[model samples]
Target: MNTRLLFFLLIICPLSAVCQTFTSSNLPILVIDTRGGTILDDPKIVADLRIIDNGPGKRNNLTDKASFTSVMGIEYRGATSQQFFPKKPYGIELRDSTGINSVAKSVLGMPAESDWVLNATYNDKTLIRETLTYDFYRKMSKYYASRFRYCELVLNGEYRGIYIVMERLKRDKNRVPITSIKKTDITGDAVTGGYILKIDKTVGSTSRSWKSPYPSGPRNINLDIQIDRPKPEDLAEEQFQYIKKYVSDFEASLAGSDFRDPTKGFRAFVDEQSFIDYLILTEVCKNVDGYRLSAYFYKERDSKGGKITMGPIWDYNLTYGNADYCEGNSYMGWAFNFSRVCPKDDFVLPFWWDRLLLDLDFARKVKEKYKALRQTVLTPERLGAFVDSTSSALTESRQRNFVKWPVIGTYVWPNGFVGRTYEAETDYLKTWIGQRLTWMDINIESFGVLTALREEAAFTLGPNPSIGDVTLKLPLPTPTDVSLSLTDMQGRALQTRHWPAQPKGLFERTLPATDFNTGPGVYILTISTQTGPTSRVIVRE
Candidate 1:
């Protein structure tokens, strides 16, 4: 359970999400979590953890970013300020109950905890001091280091500059794929089993100790950043469906034992939105287990006709929270967000521009989706009660008074249940919703390219294995020399035809496939010309 909790906590942490640091260096708890089920006395871990191990004698364990992965992949390294971190560590345990303690002390230049929240310079300092409050945790063993952040995502929804990337573990190096067979048939079920076995994948050592805020030296954590390239927008659509399933499973898991629905965690607090709010949230924010995992389709070239569909699910880590990380993506933090993919002031794609241009569409349609889903997934009663309880729990989690979070003072919960959320804090944030709505006015446009030539090269293919000829709908830009090569999935060229590229318009071609021994399988059609290249897939019986 500790291992699973640790893994999930690491996946959800947002502060150091930018580093994608899955290093075993700073998180010494992972070191002590020898048994798979040990619960953490978290306060102890935060106070003692250090990024550098620096053997007892040399005490300088550092790693740098210059040695950052040559290729963009998931690997963790230790560095500070974009440089590898090589420093000695503080040893032995002290009885200091104050959160201001650490082994990376010298690294942080021993500044008072007051001077260091996000920025602290410690060159002559002896060690780096770390801090934590009880509100950060969900259970005594787990914390929201993955979700909550001191950084405000939206200063009134005007894009407060934040970007969050969730780091979920994918297949292990020795993982095997189960491509046994395919079932084209379909019988609709409320819950169609996912083709991908996500939750079942085992968790093991593929990450380091402190996989947060990189600069993890001597920590063999792979920091993978190059997300799968974008496929056709349709591909993105398919991924949306896949994640819709994942969310269902996660919600069901909440019903599992040992889980707390957001509302009943610690104390009673009102959720600003109704059951409708939760529903709309789950609908638009289709968070799949693999939303953070980089899968094969991210780069697979097997597009039969549609583009690959997945996601950059960039604003994650704040799972089940209201703070944005780097890219002010307040899209779902209990408030309306204009656009995270594209700021209104910047030139963006037409589709997202559709969201920016018509904020009302997102607000209304999303509101409707929320309303419908709320009826089914989260009942109004369930949410109404939860709002009061969780809000109370949030108010109670405040303890061990830190100046930064003065809201923190002597607080206790009933039988381990803590109230969360400062009522005033929630209200302060809500008032900005209007300003955020106004901030979506960023200019959305791009520079047009005037190349040496111009024409619309759109085409369509159909009626494979026809007794007659195949008609290909083509929109050519100019009448130039064009060659068409037909092939199979194995790249075996089947036929070639030569023709002239027609003017920027649609044309048709009828070809006979009577010579090829094509059965019920996949085939490819490639049209090449001086303008560019286009390919399509064909299925024959």
Candidate 2:
């Protein structure tokens, strides 16, 4: 093929350019030859890094050995007895002796950033879920999502696999745009905001970690929510409390009786647009571990949005019908509803989504956003095109990657579904996403019915995101059946209390911390009336 035609083929249909030279496709090839040929499971290891790209040449193709660390989550571990599958995820930080990011030139079209993540999409046979998810989020108008490039990775002079060369989630101007908090600036707005947090299972503890003050769902599970921006040790107590209190207050609004109140409800704390976008994306993919695990939220300075914002989606390897566990393989359900199916899982999704969906205004926004996006990004034609182009781009690299690891036609943990070929995996994803979009289209049309019903019996809870006892207060609109029930975040009723009908007036009920079997997490407090049922979110100590 002519050079121009080959370039066009690589650009429009990368799969068609399989016979083309690696340099012709303009894809960066990263070569990591470990120093002294030693690779360890320990994250403290450093490795020599080099880049060979057909595009912009760097000042130095080689760099001072960068510190390398093994990156493993609860599912993917360090090593296993599985055959011919030694590839593991890794994190690379390029630093100078001065402990600053080396001011190096750009590599592989990405600007030089000290932190980079080399994702080992081993379990994801298609290898495009993470890439596709990230791209979709970036296309949205909300918070900044990570930028990535598809590249072939070579380790120890051997082709390990195809890996995504991407920017790590960090507090940078180009990444999570937020005000930086200095050690001395912990007193005011500088310290009070711009914090990145992950609501997920604990990886390891740094200096700073806190459990949710309330139970999360029906199981009353209190999850370990970690602070990602300020290393726990480096973060001061006052600064920590400031951000934590802000989140607590936000939860308080979400759990309050007047939650839908314009000035006092959860809407006051979170950017509604951002939340809507986040929910749509999460539901669209039906990501199994989405809201419960690998969930990221960031808060900016009081001068900025000044509230906790859901953003910059991370760790989507098990999404897009890729995982067999937790109904991830099914395209007809919502991922946020994970608690409804697996109520007792260690990492339960927070009740935030459930409560948010209860608001008709919020639900309508989500519905509107979904419909709008379908005309654009989420449309079948556009989404299918993305899947096709991406699959084509990775065709040759994927074959090489699978050959190296050889997990094809084999089952991987949490893989709700599996396919034997790369094409099969891509096809499954495309089909599932299409079906998911169709389901969401219909469900969102009637999204407000639940919200409207809940409003008819609206009530309030106090000291939400609470640690211990909670008091619920409601007004008896009329003399009708009055019964109160407590539920975990997933809406599974845990305890129910009934009250005899009384004249219209203020009514109060106290729920001690012990009343909720699960402690220090989020739970729902609902009041059922002859008209309908209304609920509020409460946190137990």
How many clashes show up per model?
A: 90, 23
Q: Please, what is the whole-model Cα lDDT of each candidate in the order they appear?
A: 0.27, 0.68
> Which runs of model 2 end up more than 4 angstroms from their true locations?
1-26, 37-43, 56-85, 97-105, 205-207, 449-541
Give lDDT for model 2. 0.68
Give per-residue CA lDDT, model 2, range 402-453, as digits (tens): 6566777778776767777777777888888888787667556655445346
lDDT of 1 at 304: 20
- Worst 10-residue stretch by lDDT in candidate 1? 124-133
Task: List the candidates' TM-scores in order.
Answer: 0.24, 0.76
Candidate 2 versus the native: TM-score?
0.76
Which candidate should be chosen as best, given lDDT against the real structure?
Answer: 2
Relative to the true structure, candidate 1 reaches a TM of 0.24
* Clashes, model 1: 90
